[model samples]
Target: MAYGQGLADRVRTLAPDRVTTATDLFGTETAETALALGVPPERISTIAAGPNPPGGVRGTGGEQARPADLERITDAILAGEITVPIAATFPIEQIREAVTLQAGRHVHGKIVVTL
Candidate 1:
């Protein structure tokens, strides 16, 4: 899921043959945009909070990550099969700055907030 229009637009531009799901967490506009982009109606989904949210689709409760999943991920990291890039890190005191950088959406990797 993308938090802003820029990322969503990037997804649209970079998408390959199949897009399994398009979820709009913020509102209905993303879904509408997907339709405008010729994505089949059934392939789009939206999730938001309000007195009455749009869209009728309901998610089948997704599975929580099991210990085995974490173990496998850890193994991958140890084997150098997975790499996590840190875009920026900030102490808890500079949380506002970190958040502002994150909100800018130009970061290439995870922004770490240290306690």
Candidate 2:
């Protein structure tokens, strides 16, 4: 299947009533959509840098990072922490369960289904 930006689009459509006042660490492109809907730059966190940090978030590194890592290790671009993107927390073979977790069906983290 061809890749598309539909996922972002879906996020845009979430709670249309809040379209004019949604706020979070949505990306620049997503933030642009918010601006189009009357949101502000300061209200958003634009992490165009792939290895950069997300808003309100501390690091983007995987499981290898820790608080001590930042205090003890080299200041060499401290690994950024990233919340697990949906399916990573689950097995793909069990897609239905994943969808259930995403459909607001369960108390879970913000999730996404990726290929």
Candidate 3:
């Protein structure tokens, strides 16, 4: 879940030895930094979308998905195989507050705003 080089460097500096794997959903620069920090190529994985691709390495995290993949996921949701959590609900009038709450990032799941 690291988004910046600083965070990645911090992870490298403070990561526990027991942690054998890390996922970089940020970009390739962070992934390279992870490698420089002594994490093996296989242990440090990244997603294929976002600012950069995985630099030819297959992304271990499921951040990159095609339209078909999204469709399949939607189908699964419709089929009751997947569930979406709603952290909070608000009326359209409270949209501003809802946005503020989401920016706080303390909620456990999606925030729904009723129209």
Q: Which stretches of candidate 2 lie over 4 Å from their true place?
A: 1-13, 20-27, 49-85, 90-115
Counting clashing residue pairs in each candidate, in order, gives 0, 6, 0
> What is the clash count of model 2?
6
C-alpha-based local distance difference test score of model 1: 0.65
Tens-digit lDDT string for candidate 3 (33-101): 656566677776676445444543347545566768888979988999766778899999999999999
For model 3, what is the alpha-carbon lDDT of residue 72?
Answer: 95
lDDT of 1 at 81: 76
Candidate 2 global lDDT = 0.46
Question: TM-score, each model?
Answer: 0.44, 0.31, 0.43
lDDT of 2 by residue, 1-115 (tens): 1113563456556655555333334334454555555555455544342454333322223366687875653443345433233334555667787777666634434554446
Rank candidates, TM-score, best first.
1, 3, 2
Question: Which parts of model 3 are misplaced by more than 4 Å?
Answer: 1-50, 53-71
Candidate-wise lDDT, in order: 0.65, 0.46, 0.66
Clashes of 1: 0
Segments of candidate 1 deviating more than 4 angstroms: 1-63
Instruction: Look at candidate 3 and give me any clashing residue pairs.
Output: none
